[model samples]
Target chain A: MSGFIICFLIGLGGSLVYLLRRKKSVKEISLFVTFSLLGFIVWLSIFLGYKVSPDRFFGWIIDSIGL
Target chain B: MENARISGWQFFLLSLNFIVGTAFFVRPGSIIAVSKQDGWIVPLIAGIFAVLIACLWLTLASRNPGLSIVQICTKVAGKYFGGFIALLYIWFFIQLAGWVTRNLGDFMKTILMPRTPISVFHLMFLIVVCYAVIKGVETIARTIEFLAPLVVLIVVVIYLFTLSEWKWERFEPMFQVSTWQLIKDSLPVIGFPYMEAVTLMMLVPYVKSRVKTGLLLGITVATLLISGIVFVTIGVLGVTRTSHFAYPLYIIVQELQIAEFIEHVESTIVIVWLIWIFIKLCISYHCAVTGICQLFRVSDRTWIAIPLVLFISGIAILTHENIVDNIAVDTRYIFQYTSLYGIVLPVLLLFLTWIRRFRKGESGGSA
Candidate 1:
């Protein structure tokens, strides 16, 4: 769980950096950061496996995506 | 303002480092997997592919002596259209930097600090690379030139250390793999590490001399470096036993047991490999940011380095945590564009320039 939290916050921090730093338009930046973060989430979720509660739900979404 | 000279040996050595760093670390054993005893042929074939692309790069450089790739596109394609191509390339270079950056951090996790968060490693790498980029391309090139000789020296030492166990028979039956299988296996070999030399085209305009630079050095130097790399893995582990390890080269170094005391030499290999990977990533990252800044007509690329570094750090984090297939991406997307930019696109531009010149001659003659 701690590993999971750490990965998530690091990821969130990156997206925040993207939002705050780049000069691209908001819509353009939104697409970039969201896709980027979402992809990370998918990889992390699959890596951790379908554990209890919401962890299992995220894992299910990742499995459905089929890499 | 660019008057420094990187020796022929330095260029040769950089080619060696650039080509051998990642693939030789990963691919040699796979070649062994395919050809079994004939894996020796893969580097030769891959070397030829790299040379051909480099020939095109030189041709393009010669056409526009003082112009960078972005400048060439603008001159050849007209303003807006060329800007788009340059933009795509900037994105490509950025993505390439991101990929290699992530891989370097992964290496740290695998070999050194297994428990350290990957994000921190990436952040440090990005920061260091940004400092180099801000210092400018000439500095980076000179630094690489200086580092290149050291890499060659260490590689020589590694080869020497692995000498007691080499097997001559492992490289026989060189064409044993089916042609299709050989070519398919060779894709990652050509495209990933070697093809990235297309990025060097961006540096050519700044070179102090192009007269002595030849395709042989480009082709054969990296050829020897990669062969040294491949053969080191094979010589240390024997070809048959190396296929299963992901970082076979690292494993090969770990096997160096000397006089019962110098048993663990992996640290030496680790340091050398880290410098090699850092230079490779820094080269790609600088090209990407410089390309963007150049396209926007910025007066200096220095100001852009900080945010660009931050962006690449984010990008490294975003790449799939399990990015083992990065080799495949290199085979597919990177190879295609590199071949296009380094070989096909440049050839097309040169041909167009020639044709236009010929037509003008004819018209001028008629008049």
Candidate 2:
């Protein structure tokens, strides 16, 4: 939750700054920011200590259908 | 030809995102499972040995200042043969996307939507990734730069969040894996995630500036440093447990229960991994589509994205019968061919261009 807040603040700050002088397309900025938030979210979860495996039955189903 | 496309920072950071994904979440855990708790040695080996491969990429990019890897291949290898090589690379990238999709889908389904059909999940991912591809590499690079800092901050916060999980003695007896085995294992680790930066060769000519080379290299190195943080993860979680998870990093976040009241934070992790895989898939899919378009001499590549997405979805389905097979098979191939195509071939290209340049002198001009 705290990480999410921080990400929002940072993103807001970025949005404000970009809103000032730059004229890059909204689509471009939105796409970039979306990816940025995504990256942050990913790192946040990993840092929080996520576990990964593909051996359990669910992992098996996922790999079979999607991998 | 003269368009100053992606900035050096943008290209480097985007390329770095590739390294930062599923590998960071799972590598240290995976290595420790295979080689035991001594996995802290993997990142160092990855960092130190990867320079050679990176330098080879620089050589290739420097030779043809304005040509993409595909165009350069055409000039160097000639029309028919070069097109064939490019097609092979396209195939490699499609396979790469398939592997990423499976890894991501397996993680998401197991952790986020326990009852949802994995195919539905993959189709959703394919839609987002294909849309991003249609937007072009500039969109991708810009996306990465803006995301890199947030990613760092988020991970740092999470690190602090899970600081209690950091068991000190887990890292004891670090050298137990033997130098040979550590180095050997690290090769595959680096090859798949780190060394694969060589794929950025395709984007070199597209950089906004060549002077940003050093900065680009820095971004890439730091990306691996983020991977080094995984060693901290393995130390905290215990390698034996982490390897057992398909989405180890997801589980890591799921473990973060603040004050014991705010628990089950897996949704945040799921969203993030989904985005990472989406971006990875987008970039690889873009590369594949563009590579194929160049091979077939198609005018506009955007039209091919949908059909290609369908084909990729098919390949994703066929990649494995189960998560166990997918990981075992995909990891092995990613380790092997990612190196061959990503590092070795580019190095070989550099040598070939070097010799040809030497023979032709300034007239050839490394082109």
Candidate 3:
């Protein structure tokens, strides 16, 4: 778990630094940060044994529609 | 957006690779499982429907030249509604990228490196794909154009090498499946590689010319090749065993023992499939990134590419529990899910365009 966090932080920090150095627009940087953070949360949840399967969610939707 | 213009030949290869995609490895078993001995016919049926769907997409695209499906959505449906529609497509493309990524990870873990974590495969592959996508579509078009012939050559070679195992008797109990059954079973096939070719709509405007001929030929040739692969698979592995294995083509290659020295070549074949899947993922990832850029009016795809790759890897890991669950969801829900983008939306857009054109003609006539 510690290893995973360190690796995630490295990736996040590396990309953030790269984007900053390039002087991207605010909207672009924010969008990147938002997506990166969302990705972090998702992987963290999975690491913590809390997987939210999209296939099941989709299956439920299909069942509800009687397809 | 990057002023990238691919030639008609590159467009043809792109369409062909996109349709074949991961379907080459993952889809055949399910198709065979459903259609039984006559499974080879499913691609033909699905290809016919796919051509019809492609017609809808082409007509819509030709009428509004140089505009991608995303731009067309915003143009035809007005800003608010069209933006919403475009958003749905972006999600679809992302979801598809997730699936393709997961498929690669699953295949790698199950077959090649059982000890390594599936996440490793997913992350590594996505990072490479992200790089290609960031480089722009011309890079991708050129890369695939170079790789496409090698893929074809390898497939043809595999077909040739496996001919010694072919048996005509395997097809003896043919046409036993009723036409209705064949069509019904082919729905998932259509929804999959065929309808999924709607992703090519994202690339149609990139081609310099001959969009119609190139697109149709790509679909036609891919369909024929895939049908031939399934036909050969059924002949070699027979219906019962072919339907059972998860990667039947892999199994066929594994069993290929020419002169007793040319053996265990499945690993080499896996490399070829890796190229195919890479091209497929790149196109979907490209479309998703492009869609986001166009929809949001974002100028640079570079910043967005890395972030989206991370999100896609997360979705890939979260999408399914295992291969069985993956296949089950696909068989049950994929057709209906994809039809919204592939069939319903294109038809609706074409109809609306016709209606608007007619109204304009009427006003002009009155004037």
lDDT of 3 by residue, A1-67 (tens): 7897898889889878987898888888887787788788888888899999877887798889898
Q: Each model's C-alpha lDDT?
A: 0.66, 0.65, 0.89
Residue ranges of candidate 1 with Cα displaced over 4 Å? A1-67, B1-13, B169-175, B178-181, B211-216, B328-334, B355-367
Fraction of the native A-B contacts that model 1 recovers: 0.00
Task: Give the best candidate by TM-score.
Answer: 3
> Between candidates 2 and 3, which one is better according to TM-score?
3
Summing lDDT over every window of 10 consecutive residues in candidate 2 chain B, give the lowest-scoring window. Answer: B211-220
Clashing pairs in 1: none
Q: How do these models rank on DockQ, best leading?
A: 3, 1, 2
Q: For each candidate, what TM-score against the reference?
A: 0.78, 0.78, 0.95
Tell me, per candidate, how large a share of the native contacts it keeps: 0.00, 0.00, 0.66
Q: Write the per-residue lDDT of candidate 2 for residues B1-367, one digit (tens) a residue.
A: 2233777667666666766666666565566667667776677677666666676667677787877677777767778876666766776777778767877767767656779877677778887888877788888777777766766677667777888788878776667777898888786677667665555666666776752464356535754565566676676787778777665666778878888799887676665656567667777887776776565555445445654555566556556667677557545545555666776667666776777777789666767
Looking at candidate 3 chain B, the ten consecutive residues that score lowest on lDDT are B27-36
Clashes by residue pair, model 3:
none
Off by over 4 Å in 2: A1-67, B1-4, B210-226, B330-333, B362-367
- Candidate 3 per-residue C-alpha lDDT over B1-367 given as tens digits, one digit per residue, 9 for 90 to 100: 7689999989988998888888888877888888878999999998998888898899999888999999999988889999999998998899899999999999999999999999899989999999999998999999998887788788888999999999999887888999999999989888888888888899887889999988999999889988888899999999899878999999999999888788998987898899998999999999999998898888899878888877899899999989999988889888998999999999888887888789889999999
